[model samples]
Target: MLVYHLYSGGKDSSLAAWILTRLGYDVRLVTVSFGILDNWRFAREAAENLGFEHRVLYMPREILERAADMAIEDGHPSNAIQFIHEKALEALASLPEVERISDGTRRDDRVPLLDLPKARSLEDRFNVAYIRPLLGIGYRTIKELTERLFVVEIRESEQLEKADYEVELRHLLRERGIDPLTIFPKSHYQSRVLGWRGQL
Candidate 1:
């Protein structure tokens, strides 16, 4: 079966792809862009290093605008981020070759998490499996696994601007004369994989 893995070029997603590949599944790495500047280049590079076919899916700016509006309305971006993720999965589920959707979400992930109700809803509506291989794994284990498996460049999330969907939304909010800090929580972390060393 084909697994469409949502890739962010971050350690978690990359490791998730690696795990699935080792399991002998046909895995394709997919990155979704919000019509803003993004680190899709890094995602492509990571996919190449992992020896997987990579695809970039562009979500329209309007969709992002709606998500931003949701954040504005709800007074937090977590819900907005989850909305974008669900939309991304829906887009992938439309593909005929995709039998399953996967992401690098770990047990500790809060934002962009697919709650059980949402997962069940998606499965019922799309007839595709939504899998998060790292969901049962803790943050420390994920970090250890990534370090053991790859040579990575860990940096602050701001340094890797545009690497996240929220970046685009923040920019859009700024353009609209709104303060992003009013919506997004302070202090989020993200990373990029420079290369993969054979498993230690």
Candidate 2:
């Protein structure tokens, strides 16, 4: 069966691909570019190392821009969640003969409400299965799996290498005993703060 792995080249995602391959499935790797995190090259290397076809889809920047806007504020908007997963689904649907789509999400990653169920629903609706092999596995197990396969760490692109200014600012605020999310206004307000520094 042909499977498409929603990969970010992160430890969890790569491990998901490895497990699926060991099960005798033909897996293809897919990554969505959201402007901020352009880790496409890393994803390609990971796919090549694992011996699977790799594809990258550049998601519309404006959509992710809106999601970022919502996430910066309130930190609990469903819009951002919808926007991201929708993009991933779109990318997956465009591939040919994709029997299933697998992502790196684990049980630990699904504490609060996200669109994971909706993702599964969409997969079913599209006649494709959404699989999460890493759900039961812990982080340590994922690392061990990658090492056993001699998975090489793919180099991140320059854009992804440079941290987003807002992230850096949030870290700085946390160090100063300030919850950036607590004090910073959501959406446009947070945009203004990041704007002063000339970026988000």
Candidate 3:
């Protein structure tokens, strides 16, 4: 069976591909670009370094924006990112031989109801299975796995940390004796709140 890893050339995505490869699966890596960053190039280079087949999908900025707008209209925050993710899935599904899709989602990625929200349920909507084998691990665990598997290490991007302004606002509010959830609730994007929400 052929499985494609939803690759972003990040630590988690690379580690997922490594693990699946070790398990004897034919794994390919894919990255979707919205023309905002060079993430697609990174993913391609990393995949080549690991000796895995890689593909890039360059999506139009307008399509991504409209997807994000529709997601928010449907009451999903940070719908832009989610829209991009789904678009990536769709792109992967169009490939000639892929049968399943996997990503580096971990259990530590908990963010209330939104992280695994019904909105991003690819299995239900796309009829394709999305797997997260690292669902119960932490960042440290992913690092350890990468080292053990001899996968190339990826540098963390500061842009990822700065992607969500409201989350930073919430952290500041919490220091002043305010519960950010009471003010903003779980409205921020999953990419923002998933890391810090449980820590708070």
Candidate 4:
């Protein structure tokens, strides 16, 4: 079966794709662009390094705006990020060739998590399986696996500036003369892959 892996060029998602490949599934890497400044180039490069076909999906800015507004109203971006993630999953699930959908979400992931209710609904409505290979793995394990498999670059999320859903929403807010710090909490982290270093 074909698995559409939601890739972000980070350790988690990249590791997810790696795990699926090792399982002998036809895995395709997909990264969604929500009109934010991001390091999507790294995602494409990572796909190349891993020898996987990659595709970029463009999400409307308005959808991101709705999520941002929700976050602003609730005083936290977690719910907003989750909303964006569900929408992303919904879009991926609509693909006829996609029998299963996967992401790099770990057991410790808070925002962008596929909650039980949403997961069930997606499965029931789309007749597809939402798989998270890294769900039961912790942060240390994810890092170890990634380091063992690929050449990755670790940096602060704000520095990369273009790879996250919240980054786009934050940019929108800044453009409107609003401070993102007023909404999002401090010290968020994201990952990037520089190249591949053979397979584990």
lDDT of 3 by residue, 79-197 (tens): 44445565666677666566688877667754211256653565556666667778768778866765555434222222233222233333434555655455443533222111111
Q: What is the C-alpha local distance difference test score of candidate 2?
A: 0.58
**What overall lDDT goes with each candidate model?**
0.82, 0.58, 0.57, 0.81
- Collision pairs in model 2: 73-186
Q: Which candidate is the best by lDDT?
A: 1
RMSD versus native structure for model 1: 2.2
Model 1's lDDT to the true fold? 0.82
Tens digit of per-residue lDDT, candidate 2, span 1-200? 87887766556666677688878888888877655444466556655655669887666666655655665564543455545666667567666777688777776664212355776666767788877787877768865765555434333222233222233334444555656556433432110000101211
Q: What would the TM-scores of all predictions be?
A: 0.89, 0.64, 0.62, 0.90
Ranking by lDDT: 1, 4, 2, 3
Q: Backbone collision count in every prediction?
A: 0, 1, 1, 2
The model with the greater TM-score, 2 or 3, is: 2
lDDT of 4 by residue, 25-108 (tens): 889999888756655666787788778899988888888889878987898888888888889999999888788999988899
lDDT of 1 by residue, 1-200 (tens): 78999998878888999888888778989999875775677788877876779989897888899998998999998889888988998988878877899998878878788889988998888889988889999978887898888887775555663355767778888988998877766676668776777632
Query: Poorest 10 consecutive residues of model 3 by lDDT?
Result: 191-200
Stretches of candidate 4 off by over 4 Å are 36-39, 198-200
